[model samples]
Target chain A: AQSVTQLDSQVPVFEEAPVELRCNYSSSVSVYLFWYVQYPNQGLQLLLKYLSGSTLVKGINGFEAEFNKSQTSFHLRKPSVHISDTAEYFCAVTHMNTGFQKLVFGTGTRLLVSP
Target chain B: DVKVTQSSRYLVKRTGEKVFLECVQDMDHENMFWYRQDPGLGLRLIYFSYDVKMKEKGDIPEGYSVSREKKERFSLILESASTNQTSMYLCASRSGLAGGLYEQYFGPGTRLTVT
Candidate 1:
């Protein structure tokens, strides 16, 4: 079974401050990683995804993530965050080789960006 | 643009009532999914369909059933609405093979509240 773990439940940051949301996954086979963001009372939107090549993947809203194979981590980061970036972020993974291709999602980390 | 749309943005239902959540995709996607999002639980897949009349149970499918009579539309049915079933229901669609690398397009979501 593939599972994703997000270490933090909530992260508070001021505007223009750097933010990092950590995510780790446990899967025996090759996995595809993804980041999604959801605003309050809204559905989730895709941020970035790491399918195969280029571990360092950049996403919308100036967010990026690095997929570390050995560590089994895909952490999302941004140099500076804006107030509009305040949302719930989720990390998801799906096994590439497994026939059951449903995405396993993390518990989510609420990023609270304030001015 | 690939667009996934849900029939209702917000719904309030009474306990023990039957509930239906509708989702439609405009992109002729072969795969469709239903997920529920809760605080601290993120998104958990309830069901998915790869083709019309084909459905697969996801991690949490005990209280949910799905219908895919058409290629572009998927409907989730809750046999008996319970307070525990109150959460944001998300619909997604993808246009490729099951195990291949493809990002899912999400709908605006239907927030279901069972009181």
Candidate 2:
């Protein structure tokens, strides 16, 4: 079975500060990585995904993530964050094989951006 | 835009009552999934359906069941509601592999409270 682990539970940062949320996964085969963000009382929206090629993947809202195959990590990063970026972020993984194509998500990291 | 909608935004149910959570997608996606979100524990898949009347148990499907009578609609059924089952329920839909990398579109989610 595959699983995703998000190391940080909560991150507090001031506005315009750089942020990086760490994520690691355990899977035997090739897998796809994704980052999602959820605002207060709202559903999750896809931030970015790494399907194939390009270890450095860019996402919405001026965010990016680097897929490290050697370390089995896909960490999300942003050059600077705004107060509106305060939300819950999740990292997910899914295998590329056939079957149900179920996605496994991490415990989530709460990004608290204060002005 | 792919739109997935849940039947209720919030629901209060009594213990031992039967609960049904409905989800509908307007994109005519081939796959539908039901998940439960809890604090400190990200989204856990309960059930998923790849096609009409075709359902599969996910990572945690102990006390939950699901139904997919049509291609665009999926319903989650809780046989006996319990306090521990109170959490945010999310529904998602995704197209098959034909469209290259499949990305799941999520609904607004239904917050269920069992008392």
Candidate 3:
């Protein structure tokens, strides 16, 4: 079975500061990794994904994640965060299977950006 | 833009009531999914459909059921709504072709409150 683990339940940071939300996954087969963000009262929006590419993946809203196969981790990072960037972030993983049947998600990390 | 719309934004129901949450995707995608998002637990899949009249159970489907009579629409049914079942329900769709490299489009989400 595949599973994802988010290290932090919440991360509080000041505006314009750098932040990282750590995620780790365990799967028997090769996997596709993803980051998703959910704002208040809104559904999740894709932040980024790593299918078969370079280790570093860039995403919308100046967010990025590094897919470290050696460590079995995909950690989301932002050089500078804004107040608007405060949201809940989720890490998800699915095996590299054809037709994609399942996606396992970790408990989210709530990012709280303050001025 | 790919659009996934839910039937309601907010709903309140008493326990033991039969509840139906609807979702429709404008994109001619082949797969649709239903998930529930909680504060720290993130999004947990309840059910998914790959085609019309075909459904599959996800990781958490004990209190939920689903229907996909048509390609573009999927409905989540709760036979007996309970307090523990109150959550933010999200609907997502993705193309089944090309090995699902494309991101899943999400609805705004329905916040269900069970009493």
Candidate 4:
């Protein structure tokens, strides 16, 4: 079973400040990584994903994540964040070998961007 | 654009009552999923259907059942609602085509309250 772990529960930053939410996963085989964001009262939307290409993956809303196979980490980062960027972010993983295609998610990290 | 819609945004039900949550996807996706979200716990998959009449239990599916009579619609059922089951329910859909990474698209979610 693959599981994701988000190190930080909450991160508070000022507007325009850089932010990083740490994520680590445990899997026995090759896996795909994804980041998702959930705004208030809304479902989650995909931020970015890492399949098999470059280690550095860029996502929507000016966000990016780096996939480090050695450390088993896929941390999400944003150089400059806005007040609108404040939301709950989740890190998910799925194994590439199976066709089941089930995603295992982390506990989530709440990013609070203040003015 | 892919659109996943739930039948309700908010629902209130009493204990032991039968509850049904409906989900429909417009993109003709072959895979549909049901998940529950709670604070401090990210989305946990309750059930998923890869095709019509084919359903699979996810990590947590003890009190939940699902129906997928039609390809575009998947329904989650709570045989007897409990307070522990009160949470935000999310529905998602994805394509099952081979050779392409399937990204799950989510709905706005339905907040269910079991009193």
Ranking by lDDT: 4, 2, 1, 3
The residue pairs in collision within model 1 are none
For residues B1-95, write the lDDT of model 1, one tens digit per residue: 88899999999999999999999999998999999988888888999999999999998999999999999999999999999999999999988
lDDT value, candidate 1, whole model: 0.92
> Lowest-lDDT window of 10 residues in candidate 2 chain B?
B95-104
Clashing pairs in 2: none
lDDT value, residue A37 of candidate 4: 94
lDDT of 2 by residue, A25-95 (tens): 99988898999999999999999999998899999999999999999999999999999999999999987
Which runs of model 3 end up more than 4 angstroms from their true locations? A98-100
When summed lDDT is taken over every stretch of 10 residues in candidate 1 chain B, the lowest stretch is B95-104
Mind giving the per-residue lDDT tens digits that candidate 4 earns over B79-103?
Answer: 9999999999999999988522778
The DockQ values of the predictions, listed in order, are 0.72, 0.64, 0.71, 0.67
lDDT, model 3: 0.91
Q: Which is superior by lDDT, 2 or 3?
A: 2
Q: Chain B alone: TM-score in each candidate?
A: 0.97, 0.96, 0.98, 0.97
Ranking by DockQ: 1, 3, 4, 2
Where in model 1 is the C-alpha error above 4 Å?
A: B98-100
Model 4 complex DockQ against the native? 0.67
